[model samples]
Target: MSDQVQRDQTLDISQSFIVQAPAGSGKTELLTQRYLKLLSVSDEPENIMAMTFTNKAVDEMTQRVLSALKSSFKPKPKEPHKQITYELASQVMQRSDEKEWQLLQNPKRLKISTIDGLYSLINNRYPLPSQLVPRQIMAENWARDNAYRYATEQVLLMIDDKQQGRAIADLLLH
Candidate 1:
C-alpha cells in the first residue's frame, strides 16, 4: 500500500498531503506503511509523527513502525552502516518540519502532567499574566506541600464544623 503511494507521483515535502480513506479500507495499514516510508527517508523522523486516538492505537502504531523499520533498516550503498542514533533523535526533536512532532517534543509542554506544571510555566513566563507571585518559589509539588501544611495548622487552631473544616483542608492540601 505504502510502496504504491511512494511510487505514485512524488510526495511533495513542500506541500501538505491528505489521503481520505473510507471506513475499513485499509486506512490503518496505509497510514502506518506510509508513516514508515516517510520515517525512513525523513532527515527528521521524529518530525514525521502520527497520532492515534487511544493508548491501544498508540501502542499498535509504535510497535508496527518499530517492527517495520527494524525489518527494512539495513545498510545501504549511499549510507553504509548507518543506524538511527539517539543523537539523531535529539537533533530531530530539537528541530523539525512536522507540527505534531514539534508539539510532542517541545520542552515547554507539560506532557500528561498536572495543571500546576502549566501554571508554573506560565508564572515563570509572566507572573502577572498568569496571576501568580512574581518571585521564584518552589515547584508545584512543593507549593502544594506547603499549602497543606499551612491548612493543617489552620485546622488545628480551632474548627467546630467538621464538614466545613474537611473541605477547607482538602482545598488547601491540593
Candidate 2:
C-alpha cells in the first residue's frame, strides 16, 4: 500500500497499535488524528486512553486533540489529510455537539497522560495486592539518592575498623 494509505489505516481507531518514532517526526500529529478518530465513533471520551513518556507530550497531545475538535466545527479546505481528520470530528459533532462539548470539558476523565500519570490513575482506582500503605511517590532522583545512602550505610555497618574495610567504608562515606 501507499504510505498515505497506510497512514489512513493506522489512524483508523478501530485497531489497536503502538507507534514508535523519533522526535519531531509527526508522532504527535498521528496521535491527535487517532484520538479524533476515537471521538468519531465513541460517545464517552473517558474510555479512550492516550499515553506518552513525558508530561509535556501528554499536554501537547491533549491540546492538539482539543484544537482538532474545535476546528471540526469551523470550515476548512478539503485537503485529503486534513479532510480525513476533520471528517471524523465532524461526525462526532453531528451526533451530539452538547455531549461532545461536555466530554471535552473534563480533561481528567479523558485519560490523556504520561506514564506516571497513568500510574497515579491506576493506583487511585485500585488497591494493591500487596496491601502496602499508600503514600505519595517520591521524585525519581530523590528516591534513587536515598536508596544509595541506605545501601552505603548498611555496607558501612558490615565493615569493621580493619585497615582495608575502614578504608572502603571511609570511601563510601565521602
Candidate 3:
C-alpha cells in the first residue's frame, strides 16, 4: 500500500508500530506522518517518543514533523496526500494552537531523537549506578575515547613485559 493509505489507516491507533523499509522508501515521511497523527489526536507531542538509528534521521524526522505542523496552518497543498495530512494536523491543532506552537518553538518536549539521544536524556534525568559516572552523549565520542584509552593501556602493559610482550606488541602494531 502507498504511504498515504497506510498512514490514514493507522492514524487513530495508539499502539506501538515499526516502519521497516529500504532507503528512499519514504520511511521518514511515514514516521513524520505518524507523529503528526499523534499530535492530531492528543495535542501532546511530549507524550510521543520516537527513536531512530542515527542523529541525521532524528534531525530529519524532527524537521519534517515541524514543517508539516507549520504548513498545516497555511493553505493546503495541491497534492492530495499533503492536503489530507495537513488538514488532519490542522484539525488536531485547532484547539491548542498556542501549546503546539510553543512545542514547535521548544523541541525538548517533542521527544523525537536517536536512541543515543533518548539514552542521554534518561541518564541525565535519573541517577546512575553508584559505580558509574554520568556519560557524555555519542556526539562527544565518549565511548571511542574510552576504548582508545583502554587499548593504549594494554599496549603499554605489553611493551613493559619482557617475555611475549615483543611478539604481542608487534602483532598489535601490524
Candidate 4:
C-alpha cells in the first residue's frame, strides 16, 4: 500500500475532496497530516476547509491539527513530532475566519453526527427529481416508539401466549 498520498496527482482547488476510509483505519492521522500539509503551502490561512462526518471526528481532527501546529510553529523543541499522533486530544476547534466559525459552531459542525444528519445535507445540496416521490420520511424517533407499541398491542390481542411468542420471533427475524 502507498504510505503517502501523491500530491502531484490531479486536484480541483475549488471542490471538496472526499476520502472513504474503512472503520478502525487511521483516517484521523491521515486527515490531520493532509490538513497540516495544506496549511504549509497556503498563502491564505483560511482557504483550506477540512471536515469530519461526525462530532467525534471533528474533535479528533482538531486536536491533531493543533498539536501538529503547536509543535511545527514553535522554535527549537524537544521530541519534535510528539504532536503527530494526537495522543493528547486536547485542543479547541476554531475557525480561521472567526465569523464563519461562530456561525457553524453548533453540535452540527462540532463533528459528532448521526447518519440521518449527513443524508439530509446531501439531499439539500443535490435535490432529488421534480416528480419523484419525496425521500422516505425519516422517523427520527417514531420508528422505535411505534414499532414497540404495535408489537405490544399485537401480543396483548393474541389469545394464547405460545402462539404469540412464535409470531414475535418470526416478526423479529423477518
Please report the candidate that would top TM-score against the real structure: 2
TM-score for each predicted model, relative to the true structure: 0.37, 0.65, 0.63, 0.36
Clashes of each: 0, 0, 0, 4
- Per-residue CA lDDT of model 3 for 46-158, tens digit only, reads 77788888988888888877787678779879987677668766765673475544665666667888888888878786656762544445435777899999988887777
Instruction: Give the Å shift of residue 155 in candidate 4.
Output: 76
**Residues 57-124, model 2: lDDT tens digits:** 88888787777767877897478767766777677566446565564455565678888888888887
Positional deviation of 97 in candidate 2, in angstroms?
Answer: 3.0
TM-score of 3: 0.63
Candidate 4 has which clashing residue pairs, if any?
Answer: 54-111, 54-112, 55-111, 55-112
Error of 3 at 107 (Å): 3.3
Give the candidates in order of TM-score, highest first.
2, 3, 1, 4
- How far out, in Å, is residue 144 in model 2? 37
Overall lDDT per candidate, in order of appearance? 0.49, 0.72, 0.72, 0.49
Candidate 4 per-residue lDDT over residues 64-160, each given as its tens digit: 5655544443544454234432322212222323333431233233232346656666676565677244344445346778999997887756735
In terms of lDDT, the poorest run of 10 residues in model 4 is 85-94
